[model samples]
Target: MSLARRSLMEAAAARFGWRRAYGDTTQVDALLTEQTETAYSEAADHAALATAKNTDALHLQPCVLDVRGRVLGDALYLEGLLSGARARGLAPELIERLEHAVDHGHELTVLLADTVRTTTAAHATGH
Candidate 1:
């Protein structure tokens, strides 16, 4: 495993108070996959909620923008991690998952932009 990946795994273990088995590549891979999925899932849910029509988009604009920024930053970080994984010849599935997470962030950005525009228009028209 790459140093970056190993460090991330170790940090996660520390944060979660989980025991780490030294030199266990399988466990490292599993933890990476699970963490990637969980982060993506949470970002996806937040994006959906922020863009939902029933939401008070106008009132939530600041918070939504902050979340969008965070998601984009996370996607960029994942891209770096993906590069490291590729260089290290990691599993194809893990690389694919990283790509998916990055794509989701990009999509969320677009969705948030549209929602903000619609909300701005509605507010201007006194709707």
Candidate 2:
């Protein structure tokens, strides 16, 4: 999940021209992964199936956020942490722990959602 999220962040960064201010030249590869033919095939298949079935499986409802809050495009600030890790040469174990913390934070978001008011983007924006 972290790997996939990092790729999305890279894409967003490229699209928005976010500069890589710091990072080493050395490349780190994941030593552990399933021997799949393609990384995105399963996700693609699920998305296609959901679309063909006209299901809400891939549907997204807008998150009603604070008006004053800034829109950090990446999920749970993982991208920022990843950049920091690279800049400071942090250990992989610490990065993994941080990823776990983000997962926990997402769990909290789900738990806290019921307490907050929510509406569609159209409704929230009076569109």
* Candidate-wise lDDT, in order: 0.80, 0.53
The reply for model 2, stretches above 4 Å from the true place, is 1-75, 86-89, 117-127
RMSD of 2: 14.3
Task: State every prediction's TM-score relative to the real structure.
Answer: 0.56, 0.29
lDDT of 1 by residue, 85-119 (tens): 99999999999998888888788888977776777
**Of the candidates shown, which would achieve the greatest lDDT relative to the real structure?**
1
Please identify model 1 stretches exceeding 4 Å from their true place.
Answer: 1-57
What lDDT is obtained when candidate 1 is compared to the true structure?
Answer: 0.80
